[model samples]
Target: MTSTAREAELLPAEDAATYAEWFACLAEPTRVRLLQAVAVAGSKSVGELTEQLGISQSTCSHHVRKLAEVGFVALNKQGTTTRVSINPACCTGLPHAADAVMGVLAPRPCCPDNLACDVTVRPLEAGDWSAVRRIYAEGIATGNATFETEVPTRRALESKWLPGHRWVAELEGEIAGWAAASQVSNRTCYAGVAETSVYVGDAFRERGVGKALLHKQVTAADTDGLWTLQTSIFPENRASLALHHSAGFRTVGFRERIAKHRGIWRDTVLLERRRSVESPE
Candidate 1:
């Protein structure tokens, strides 16, 4: 680990209690199930959660209240029924908190993700899978770009990526690059808080294709109610680091030897950009 990465390992005294409280709130298995249920199934009444989770109404209500107290979920009363939903902000905040505690990242100062092609940016459609994967394979060919030695299957990418946030760029008529976001967590409160990936084809490098694709990705995320975006990059990939920096991402610090690529341990710089303005939606 480098000096910055080593120095970052200690948890700050001031934040200790807050992180502890956040973790404690989900200590119960029932509460965990409730959060996953709300996240996957959307907002639900206490009665609905009770039936879905196979718990009694009173028990369901009690756990929901507990989660709400720590900002994990929110409850709204509609006449006789109380609807429980995941907190939009906490969707990103809690995971960021955990990463900070583990010395893998720094606390937010505040935030913001993007790309291009003839250069046109549009939502990626089913027909674009081959092009997207081709671009992905090209990116993987660059040793510093990603850890994957082989391109992931389209079905694999589809299952891992969030819908609506996937985008592709075209130059003239050829797909030149792609960008997509993946869920950072399966927990309900973290819904829509995503980690982004942008890959440009070898032919499109340095052609402003990335910038165009990124613009579409972040704009779509904002309109879709995402408030935070995170990405990991190898320090050696200076162009990518610069692009993200220009897009408003701040370095959280080096996640030293975080993982292995090609049998060699690789260090990655963790970066996150929280939206400067909260999503109005």
Candidate 2:
């Protein structure tokens, strides 16, 4: 663990024990299959579970009971049939537990306070496309910034980014950098999770423009109800990695040669920040 991990909170022993129990309870392949079926099709009678999963009724009932014991599934009795439904909390709880076990959680400040004094961060505007593309082109030109060989078209970017999460930084009235977060998935289960990207113009590197943009981006995400933000950077991009770390992102993994760029395979350092979101459940 780095100083950051020492400074950051670790998963509590009790929580870890509970997560272990949850994990252990689903260790059987049949139970995993049963849980998936219930989650996908809403409530299911034991007969429906048995038929859909092609298992015997006794086996289905046994596995459903195991899942219920760990609170992963709920059982209801309607008439003589027992209806099994996935727990609403499991939608969030399972992913959170995985993050906890992997030590990918980030309980940090809303944003870094040491934001660039000379930079002003603001919501991206329609007319900012020209400058935004120019800055994006700068990032694309740096082969290490992304796997993209060319800057994305404005329409393409606009459609991809979450509307309110797009932001830009102005240094001396010029666009110096930009930051945005996009949905990690369209599924409702992952509605509050996003993948983040920060790009600083080449000339603005080391001027704190990246941090300034990130300060606004992350804090806005927290206020806007994002629970987790993640990004991947090439291992060689130390400056970008440092800027993200200042914003409290932790390296979750080192993806070995995860993709190719310019005919060469490249490794990426996966980083993530988890904002503690209040659960309606």
Candidate 3:
């Protein structure tokens, strides 16, 4: 195994202890339910949580104190009422902690299983622009793909997408979908992090075209030494979410009321996948 893999397999002693402390605080079923209640309600008074959880006030108070000690929940005082709210950091940190404990945090090889064998994924060629943009247009029409009203011009897309990381999927020799990674920032420090986008043509919605394209896209990103890939997906797009999750992506957080799409507010699910271990230089 590579040194990077070894490092991922073993968490630091200090971190393990810290994580253990946090986990220990939530060992009780009541504490877990308490945290969940606070997380969903955003904030709740002790009495409110007690009533919602069907637990006694004293028992709820004791468990809330335990969770607060580990920074899982925060306490606020307004007049005589003490309200408990979940620590926003825990929203992302705890999931990452779970991923670390389970070996899924480590990057693995391409995961193109049970995909349609006839669908071919190839690097985007110059002649593929027409089909690529047409597919993008289809995605725009769905009102769930992106906030953009129209497909970006080919020149604009080419300049934004990272060279050598653009791809096209073909079903029976016709372009069915496309995937590409765009540099998230111009700073040298963020060169390895990218925001990715994928779209399937209207005719190719459920034929495993997305699964095949993502397999090629993620594998290529790993080989090219990219360390992080992130994407924002509309919460309503369940198919896209499942596809990315299969490729090792995890939900980092939800951006509620994040932006306006067509004159109405919309929420987005922010997701990211980090390289499991560094590839050899």
Indicate which candidate wins on lDDT: 3
* Model 2 Cα lDDT, one tens digit per residue, 11-42: 77899799989999988999999989989987
- Give Cα-based local distance difference scores for all models: 0.83, 0.87, 0.89
- TM-score for every candidate vs. truth? 0.59, 0.63, 0.72
Error of 3 at 210 (Å): 0.8
Better of 1 and 3 by lDDT: 3
Q: Between prediction 2 and prediction 3, which has the larger TM-score?
A: 3
Which stretches of model 1 miss by more than 4 angstroms?
Answer: 1-117
Query: Residues 124-225, candidate 3, lDDT per residue (tens digit)?
Result: 999999999999999999999999988899999999999989999999779999999999999999999999999999998899999998888877888888
Sorted by lDDT, highest first, which candidate order results? 3, 2, 1
Displacement of residue 104 (Cα, Å) in model 1 is 18
Candidate 3: global Cα-lDDT?
Answer: 0.89
lDDT of 3 at 130: 98
Q: Rank the candidates by TM-score, best first.
A: 3, 2, 1
Query: Which of the two, 1 or 2, has more lDDT?
Result: 2
Which pairs of residues collide in model 3?
107-276
Clash total of candidate 1: 18
